[model samples]
Target: MLSGRLVKWMLLLSEYTITYELAKAVKGQAVVNFLAAHPVPDNETISDDFPYEQVMMIEPLNLWQMYFDGASKISGTGARVIFITPQGDLLPYSFTLVIGVYDHTPNYTRSPEEYPSAANSGRLLKGKVAIITGGARGIGAATAKLFALNGAHVIIADILDDLGPTLADSIDGRYIHCDVGRESDVESAVNLALAWRGQLDIMFSNAGVAGPFGSITNLDMDKMKDLLDVNICGMVHGIKHAARAMIRGKRGSIICTSSSAAIMGGLASHAYSLSKEAVLGLARSTACELGVHGIRVNCISPHGVPSEMLVTAYRNFFGKADMGPEEVGRIVGETGSLLRGRSASMEDVAQAALFLASDDAGFITAHNLIVDGGFTSAFSTMSFIYQ
Candidate 1:
């Protein structure tokens, strides 16, 4: 019964009404202003004190080249990385960045030109002799590689007979099978290093385990004793022999690996935390006594590095054996990290060891370098603001 002319008129009237009402509503809404394209220089806040204008003096993207960078949604204020690629260039693509997130510039382009003909020409621990405990894996292994690359004659001491010898051969260093928990074994390892190189300049004691994770109500006393033997007695044995050699030379650097669990509870089981704290106390007391002989003793407390032992713990807890280190690091970083940018790596702990061993830390001694990236620095109150 409806006419074609009437249907067309109704459709046109409905369209007009919607358009008018939408326009009116849009006009009545409040206007929003956006920030400037560039960052404003503010000296009042520490984070904003950088001279952004000077640092951002970058060339515009050119033909066959592009640069893209942005802020992360979580932190909202971190480093911006850029990549530039040339057309038809696959193998020789060069990367250059003006600034990094840590306020250091990327030396990718300049490194090659600045390097000498030899790789280990200008090394930090050149011509030094170093001994690293647990050098077959984890932080100790990384530090051994670093020390060898830096021109140090390294000795990899570990109970892992196969891996220890293999790593030693690869790095052109020597290996000795000696359990650190046994005083005699530790002494033999130190003596072997001394006999080979005639002196010991650096000793890195970095071996630990997270004892059986269980409630205190059902504590395993035997396992707890074993944990103390390896974590606490191990360091005592290392220091006993290492200090003897260092005292003969009247100069040395002795480093130990502790844990952030030492300072902050609940990060690890009771035995692990207690043993790590004992390491700090041992370092302090040893430093006092060793200072008279020109010997330096220090410790590094790293947080949540997913080594083999840590991975085993993770797998056992979650019933997932295939979980990777990156995933565990991501989870730990989310909870403990104050920077919220990157997770703790084995290399981070190794680098701390390197600093303590090198001449750069000559005046530093008896200090416990807590390398948790500010985790212990903040309390529960800080979670409300950053988390």
Candidate 2:
């Protein structure tokens, strides 16, 4: 039983709220402001930093067509169209902002006849040789399989010699026994790869251990040292050997697997978090020293990937007798910001590693690509509820 004027005002307020939320979702405030200040002119070529502009015309329908068609031509120039409503609502669309690199670049567009297939995707890594440590199971195994499927000659190195050979046979990769914590083992693994493939294009130093789970006050120093040796020391040895081989070749990619525990405190045991933090630091130092040799070093900080290690640690920490992998995954999903309401899969981490090792990410180095389902950004202490 509201008045007509009150209903109208409420409707207008609801529209504004929806617009604000949409803007927050896509992070489009800067783009909207940029468009507002530089209105588009009819039939006039407007050259801007990002190569797209918003046109305001008296004729909405005709201007929409003109904008769409004109934007199509700019797309050939690598620019894209973004639509904004009169009510300050922005429509969602995929767009590329062409900068200085588009000056003389060829305007190539894919037709239906030239579309990609699984066979073409497999060719993306043709002739490339990749070495993956701890490649027997979990993320390492997934990465090895993906690299093989993408046509890279893969070498699986792990202390678990039994599983390593089995996994290699399944993935069409070679196997080598490598206890990454030992410098000699790492050196031998590199030698094996060089002897077999005659070249190594990528090195994935992913061998790590979670160690014993307990309260920091009651934690065993010996257990902590063991974890550090395998996790941190292992990475050091891997980097040393990988760097030597990569330096000799004068070009390569080195990827280390860090964890989301490195970024946020209190997410894991003290030793585990320290080990991951050290891994991130190692990536930065390696990138600095090896950039001269055209070697790219990067790290992936993955969150909530289902693994036997995670399952055991959670069960031990909470003293839950019957907790399983699915329950652990559910707990992580609740803690994370997945809009789809699911935990991150091993394939997600594998894909991130693949990109870092691929030539597509050539210019990217010394960065931690966090694939955490928005955990780090979604919550802040200064929010109203927290305050």
Candidate 3:
């Protein structure tokens, strides 16, 4: 009897092989026929016969109005340039200024005295309201802080009553007890954000649990049920209620947190992987439904981050309570990776969520932004080839 994972992989392999072979065969035949009809003699090429070229046009790269501020001081030396596009897009660029022994030519003309920073930087999410599930800790916590810093009125929703209120208070945001497994809790959280801010702009459905692990033969049905309730049904509740509130505004961004295992098999437990995969399908389906109202739906699948849940999983797996983030990151990198040297971080995943929430990604929707550092792009066996 084949395992469930094996069955899934087999089906995927068969479908991919069939489609790829058919496409390759058709293209090969077309190329052969084309060459037969338009035969070329040896050493003959189009370069000599058609020795023609057209003059290229060049335009000034100044579509965005530039704002520059250069300063030098004992504290720091840097130059900040801000570009505001006609469409009201903001781009803040910071560069370090260094004056070395090559004194004849200084990079900057200004004298070292005054200090300058991006104190007047434009807030990407100004005047927006965001509700982040599982915001008390982990990726959701990072995202909540980032959103608040970017000028969004954030509402932290989580079951961690102790930490949730504290984080919310620090960010000047509100906190509500929300066990995503319950539909009423999710609906009420959305309502609270709406009531306080008068509208909902971003919804981050990020609460999830790593379900039962180990062999499929010993899989626990009770644990599987609980996993689906929080991971799948919870996300559904968020999307359903958030979309309703966003419809009133006619514009919003809904982001869900998935796992790298959702796209690639064998990276996580069966229940956890399945739940994350369901999130992608839900986002794609709901995006189509809410697109008319200008509500964008998307999900982010991040590779191993040293979250509380991940740390606990690592300790449980290795039976070592002393195992820290560095050890877990090294193990994950060795097991599955394309890019080396740096492991995926919570901030990286949060930045993805922030981008999708901001107007910079206004045209993006129904997309699964995988933040795996090229792990999904390369075959697992390719590591041996490089060695």
TM-score of structure candidate 3: 0.70
Model 1 residue 49 distance off true place after TM-score fit, in angstroms: 47
- Model 1 RMSD in angstroms: 19.8
- Which residue segments of model 3 deviate by more than 4 Å? 1-122, 380-387
Ten contiguous residues with the weakest lDDT in model 2? 2-11
Cα-based TM-score, every candidate: 0.68, 0.68, 0.70
lDDT of 3 by residue, 1-387 (tens): 211211011111122232342223223221111000011222443233221122111111211121123312122121222223355332221112111112122133332121112221224586699999999998999998778756688999999998999999877899999999999999999999978989999999999999899788999999999999999999999999999999999999999999899999988899999999999999999999999999999999998887878888889988999998888788767765666756788898988999999987999999999998888877766557767
Which structure among the candidates has the greatest lDDT?
3
Against the hidden true structure, what lDDT does model 3 obtain?
0.72
lDDT, model 1, position 115? 24
Residues 1-387, model 1: lDDT tens digits: 121211011111222332343223224333221111111112322133322222211222111111112222111111111112243211111112111121122223222222221112225586799999999988888888778755688999999997999888866799998788788988998999889989999999887778867788888999999888889999999998999999999999999999999989988888888999999999999999999999999999998787887777788888898988987888777776876756788888887988899987999999999888788878643467765
**Reference-based lDDT, residue 56, model 1:** 19
